[model samples]
Target: MVQHIRLVGIEASDKQALGYTELAHGIPHIEGEFGDVLRRSHAELIGLCAFIFRRQTPLTTEWLRQADNLLDRKLDELQRLPASHPLDQTGVILPGGNRSSYPLRWAELLGEILHPLLYRYRSELLQAPIEPYFGSYR
Candidate 1:
């Protein structure tokens, strides 16, 4: 599973600086690696969104619709599984024998952080003309 890192405000600034700092600090080619990490983090969020709303007929925002479309296209490339894939096996064994699948566990973990992150950064996240924000990712 990919670990998602949140880069809000000052943290984002710090990461940007760290990505560009010279190699004398012992880190090599950090900017490209940082960009890749950021992209994977964003993809995780997009996947969580896709998993949560896969059954919904329509999403409330255009950005969400676009994300869903992207996820759909990406998923289509994979071959169908006749049975549950190994990653789909139960991962979280809760108390009293309750269990959650790997994907569900991932979604739950992401939801815990993402909901609050979105709320805390609502002004920036919910600004008008959201399509451009999604487009920038492309």
Candidate 2:
């Protein structure tokens, strides 16, 4: 929702998306395939949020800002990775405590980094039939 202008109450049209616009300010654009991936996944997640909203769940901009703060910080760190002359590698772990290699998105990387922090909210938000936003992380 950081990359969008509206969050709710807007009708989708050929010229307009449900709650999106070109005017994104929360996270500055990262160029190249990384930027494309961020934009696409953001669209997907916002669509997912809309689905949740339709199901009577509310997503707040303040929460979005919090999320954006983390993302901005991470991306800023990542951007500095190429400049800081530090050697940090990313290794993906497998299902059974093994390790594997897979090329993926930084947004997903953000999710991985933030998921634990977000899980702390489940106790406050989860009830009845709604599952936690994310199940136990792998």
Candidate 3:
């Protein structure tokens, strides 16, 4: 079964979308139907966000749990099956699960520290006219 994860964020304005190109020339626009690679990146980003945000405050524990389960399940599924799973067939690259373990930990730690700081330091100018801060993890 294919499960889709929703990315929680406001849409970018036409102007806002332009900045994405400076870095993500290879990444297609984060809209419409995507191929496998883009979808996989989106899923990873969503999981990372859930892990980081659930650390404190009104934590979304259920979402985090589901993400964790999905991570584990996907890893196992990928190992037992071929890379030709429908999701995999589309362009979604499976993060080679083991090789990336440490980076994910580092991201969690950084998120724990930074997410709060971002909220604290945000100004009317900084906070207003703000785009959803998808950190540079493309």
Candidate 4:
């Protein structure tokens, strides 16, 4: 079954969370998807905080900055791979839904790049739990 994640309440009201969801849904990996999503989430939180008479608190701003950096890195990595390399490899065959070596490598690198950022982001915000105000529901 497909599980749905939710973050509602005051936090859910943030636009960054929506952005995070969009980025996450774009990832090619089953696991790494959340990193982009979380980054988007943190960004939304920061924006919401800024709007609520808080003009980017140092804490929220820092999180947003980190999230943006992570996203930029992911995008850069995705762009670095040649379109054909991953989609078309020489003398290789795979089962349905399996990617070619080049693309798989690109995907792995993306995982490597995203894992740490995700852990750090989670570590920092997990406690805050923005149930509806800033955190994601999984």
Candidate 5:
């Protein structure tokens, strides 16, 4: 995913890279092939955000707030899943036998990177131009 993002000349943060790596590794326990699908989907979103950030436009606080709200909803949904669900499983066995919630943690980390940019971009990101590189998951 970092390589994909770098193809567009954007250097992803260490947190973003680590989060995605953890997400990819953690997802298989829940849904096998689906993990790859999510990894690709998230990479697209991450690339898009990087592209938008690279544009350096001044964004409105309201837009940022809306973005954050959307991410919050996503986080809430992930957290609300039943413990037995594969999506909720982190595959990490702790010292006390507790499984880690790394998937949710990764999503939260992604939100951290995106939410702040809401107030930073002045114009809506024009995806058409960068669609070739950061468009739908391949």
Candidate 6:
């Protein structure tokens, strides 16, 4: 548990450092099964927008929770699993009574999820302070 938290922090720092480069190159465009790429890019843009607009509001942990929720939702869409499914090293998610300590890739999970959540809730998040102040309210 302790290591997991630290891993998340480390991954976040890396994301902040190489965010722009990642945005330019890491993501790709595709239709149908390529939705995940768009979702992540959207979330990344959300944080970038917030930074440009509100200098004071650090990206909220609420967004992180929402990203985690998004991962859960996506996994659910993939297939049915036990309440606590764990992804293997090769990204194979195993559910049920698999008593294995899941070695999750923090870089992929945290950095990716952060943006997807933000993109999904862009309206709810940006409408109040960002959009309204910028005169782009909807």
Whose lDDT is greatest here? 6
What's the lDDT for residue 84 in model 6?
Answer: 47
lDDT of 1: 0.31
lDDT of every model, 2 decimals: 0.31, 0.34, 0.31, 0.37, 0.37, 0.38
Instruction: Flag regions of model 3 displaced more than 4 Å.
Output: 1-54, 80-89, 92-128, 132-138
Candidate 5 positional error at 49, Å: 11
Ranking 5 against 6 by TM-score, winner: 6
Error of 3 at 108 (Å): 19
Q: Give RMSD (Å) of candidate 5 vs. truth.
A: 12.1
lDDT of 6 by residue, 27-127 (tens): 32333553565644543343232332222233455555666776675675435433344334234535654453333443445545555444544433321
Error of 2 at 73 (Å): 1.5
Ranking by lDDT: 6, 5, 4, 2, 3, 1
Candidate 2 residue spans exceeding 4 A from truth: 1-51, 54-59, 80-126, 130-138
For each candidate in turn, the TM-score is 0.22, 0.25, 0.24, 0.26, 0.25, 0.29
Clashing pairs in 3: 36-90, 36-91, 36-92, 37-91, 37-92
Error of 2 at 86 (Å): 22
lDDT of 5 by residue, 50-120 (tens): 33343222343444566577657667655654344344434556555777554454344444444334212
Candidate 4: count of backbone clashes, pairs at least 3 residues apart or interchain: 6
Error of 3 at 14 (Å): 31
Estimate the overall C-alpha local distance difference test score of candidate 5: 0.37
For model 4, how does the per-residue alpha-carbon lDDT over 50-129 read when each residue is reduced to its tens digit?
Answer: 21212364444655676577657667544664445323424144455555433334334343443333334332221223
What would the per-residue lDDT of candidate 3 be over residues 1-138, giving only the tens digit for each residue?
A: 112223332232211111111112223333454433444433122222322232323224433554576557556544665443334433454566322221122223333333233223222001122224667755
lDDT of 6 at 95: 60
**In model 2, where is the ten-residue run with the lowest total lDDT?**
122-131
Query: Which parts of model 5 have CA positions greater than 4 angstroms off?
Result: 1-63, 70-91, 101-138
Instruction: Report the lDDT tens digits of candidate 1 across residue range 4-52.
Output: 2343322333111111111122121224654344343442222222222
